[model samples]
Target: MYGPIADTIRTQRLVLEPLEVHHAEEMAPVLDDPRLHRYIGGEPLTLDELRARYAHLAAGPAPFHQEYWLNWIVRRVRDGQAVGYVQATVTPAAPEFTVASASAGATVTPGPPRLVASVAWVIGMPYQGFGFATEAARALLDRLAAHGLRDVVATVHPDNRASATVASRIGLRPTGETRDGETVWRLPRRAAPT
Candidate 1:
């Protein structure tokens, strides 16, 4: 199982470390912001809810169902304070559960598992528009690419213009499809310059 990698990643302005239980205190307020949760699927979380969420997330399989759902905390390099969180996991093309029609019989489809890295970032309301999300995402993508992952993807709510822009800025182009009403963008693997 790919437990926490224990490696630290540093970018121009931020550092990414594996998420720890203590980060819940700092992250709770950021996640509690209603504006930030508008595009995210769930309602704003309370401090107690955030703690339980982390506990459950941390208790999941090390090498999660697909790959690892490695969650990391983003911190500013200048002051070393937690500002956000990011996570990555493999995509199972033929996920077990599928919707069935009321009249028609079920249909089965099989396909190879797609190795994808998905990311999410949140900077406290005060830090919005400061480029923290973009920087953190770029760093995470770079880290995954360095580990030989290909075809990274980011799914964002169509109305989330800021996140959509961040995906575009990071080189992930639209894939022309939506999952659970969320727009998806992909960045294909390309050899880095020699």
Candidate 2:
């Protein structure tokens, strides 16, 4: 019932504001380029469709999954232009503690699960190669770590070299594991300051 929520995260050149339905308008143009979807294999969504999608993302995950859906709109601090977004889906990795009944010492109840997060970022075509994605992703991860959700992973298409480089720059290395047709990269437990 308890989990991490998205916060407005700021970096040296960008600010990651928690995603809202209103962000769809600005995000539409940023995501309009077809080249951006070359690897992902999807065309850009219309503004209206983006609005609906944003609405869904803002609502967080369904109750049954016990997940924390944290999404943020990445924008430039200089001009407040929305460039893209970053997101993390957090779920319990393991139980953090256990409580034993006072009268029945043998009865043990597990406390909350130690959360693990899967992170991802998208920087619009125009924003690509500007280091915004890297900076924004670092900020996201740092915030998660501060809240004890340092176990992070990212899935990248094996053919997307740029994204792979960004993942490595953020201290994640591929474990040669594939999930849902994407490569899984994990971060070290003790993340080094980058």
Candidate 3:
């Protein structure tokens, strides 16, 4: 129906729009705060750099790549202010069998591939204390779920309590796992409510 899944995700106060290179102009200043990068590492990207990065992100992965890169610009509903962005890199975890093959000796064939995603979100320094990140992350995860992606995870820096709290608020629990030094949080696949 819609052009992309992100186009259909919105919360009470925020709307997720498909990321565009033109968004870099407004987002660059919002993301320019050095403090915001404390946990994520690296300083702010320049306008030019952000534009280039956004352009590349708008272009999907190379052909034959197994990952689906979904990105969106998080905007405030009231004023359409670009607060930050949310992204998920989804890849097939494993194939699930849909039907039994020949019971005698034939190998059972699997059905569609199941998807797993690693998600991330960022809100500007000016908007950090207002719970926008939590709202946006929830919307992202909800869209992921609606898209049939049940295995979702987020990596938060150990020292970034703010991010860890957001992850927790979104039903993700620390998995006791670390990747690239950041703690991994996961929301196990649960049966959907009837």
Q: Count the backbone clashes (under 3 Å) in each candidate.
A: 0, 0, 0
| C-alpha lDDT of residue 10 in model 1 | 85
Q: Which of candidates 1 and 2 is the stronger one according to TM-score?
A: 2
Please provide TM-scores, in order, for all candidate models, with all chains considered together: 0.80, 0.85, 0.88
Q: Rank the candidates by lDDT, best first.
A: 3, 2, 1
Residue 34's C-alpha lDDT in candidate 1? 78
Q: Please, what is the whole-model Cα lDDT of each candidate in the order they appear? A: 0.76, 0.87, 0.89
**lDDT, candidate 2, 1-194, per-residue tens:** 22344668878899999999999989999999999997767899999999999999988778888788899999999999999999999887877566566764666677755678999999999889999989988898898878877789999999999999999999999997998899999997773479
lDDT of candidate 3?
0.89
TM-score between candidate 3 and the true structure: 0.88
Q: Which ranges in model 3 have alpha carbons more than 4 Å from their true place?
A: 1-3, 95-112, 191-194
In model 1, what lDDT does residue 113 have?
47
Q: Which stretches of candidate 2 lie over 4 Å from their true place?
A: 1-5, 94-112, 190-194
Which lDDT tens digits does candidate 1 get at residues 108-180?
A: 6544445666766666777778898898888878877776666688888999999999989988987888988
